[model samples]
Target: MASLGQMAAQSDMVQGLNAGLRRVPPWVLYLAGAGWAGWLFYLAATGGLGVEPIEALEHRYGELALQLIVVGLAVTPLRRHLGVNLMPFRRAIGVLTFFFVLAHFLVWAILDVQTLSAVWADILERPYVTIGMGGFLLLLPLAVTSNNWSVRKLGGAAWRRVHKLVYPAAVLGAVHYVWLAKGFQIEPLVYLGLILVLLALRSRPKATRLAR
Candidate 1:
């Protein structure tokens, strides 16, 4: 158990951290994420991302989208359990996740598949592609409504209910990754396991809730 003074210090530190976070606007993340994505594209174009630059770029963007999804899912748990608040940045994180997902799809459709018919064919014939496309479609509505105007128009409870699409979207993303990987690769499985664990944590009530 922590002493009163130690606990007080920790509380002060968290407050200070949150205060500093508030000073940073969410648009900062938007600019940084866009810049990073552009840099990755530049690297791929310049042959700096290995021999299979297009494939590498697609993987990078897809993996980054997954990471952002995980981070978005983590915000509530972190605030509820660890006393760390990231609510201010959750919308930005979500928007970036959608952006990266779109980028990943564009890379696959234009660079990898290279044909409209073949792209549609893959989505129909390939299970992984089908699943990934489903995830993307699910995110599309959420992304479109990720604004104050939509919230005001839809109302709060309705907005939240629609946003719950993220839950299944996230699971589909992990499953798509696992299905897309070759052989018995552990990396994709690790991502799937992490996503499942995060979902489970999100579903479970916090100690404070139980106390109530």
Candidate 2:
């Protein structure tokens, strides 16, 4: 039947993709992600962002950070459930996400706030800002311990325990976006839903393990 043939074709396509991704150098992914970010910054510098460039720039960084964070979280599930191995690139993705978060914060602090007193005040007065800063703080430790040197220094168990902060950081990051919006926006809701699904997928296997 046509449905059976279509399923076969799709399987072949997915197999081809998995093979190609496995062959590609891990550094290429980091280079491409960082390069695109640099391109966005270049555009912002050149007035190509249209109208409110600073706000556009901040959104660009923040969105990329959230996306990369989700992607990093999805790697294990993708490999285990979908048989698409992304283990090699997971570290690069996490580091890139942290840098994107840092860029998002700096853009808001420097271009948007422009004053130390106001920055502190906004952090205290604005609930979204407060939650955003909390998310950043959670990521800070994971970012610092991402390197091989730190891994050896901290030992595997300790390192993994610290890295577990990614879960709460991701939740807070999504919540910050939802609260940041002026009204009930669909985009933020979609992101929040996606993260919740990913978290649920991640937890199910653990719950099964704990029961045994």
lDDT of 1 by residue, 1-212 (tens): 99999999999999998899999999999999999999999999999899999999999999999999999998988888778899999999999999999999999999999999999999999999999999999999999999999999999999999998999999999999999877999988887888888888876685558888
Top lDDT prediction, candidate number: 1
| Range of the 10 consecutive residues with the lowest summed lDDT in candidate 2 | 79-88
Error of 1 at 110 (Å): 0.3
Q: After superposition, how far is residue 29 of candidate 2 from its true place, in Å?
A: 2.1
The parts of candidate 1 lying over 4 Å away from their true place are: 206-212
Question: In candidate 2, what are the lDDT values of residues 1-212, reduced to their tens digit?
Answer: 56988978877876887888889888998898889889999999899898788999999999999999889989988877877778889899999999999999999999989999999999999999999999999999999998999999999999999998999999999999999898779998888888889889988999889999
Cα deviation of 106 in candidate 2 (Å)?
0.6
The segments of candidate 2 whose C-alpha lies over 4 angstroms from its true place after superposition are: 1-15
Task: Score residue 78 of candidate 1 by CA lDDT.
Answer: 83
Alpha-carbon lDDT of model 1 = 0.94
The true-versus-predicted C-alpha distance at residue 122 of model 2, in Å, is 0.7
Clashes of each: 0, 0
Local accuracy by lDDT, each model:
0.94, 0.91
Model 1 clash number:
0
| TM-score of each model, in listed order | 0.94, 0.92
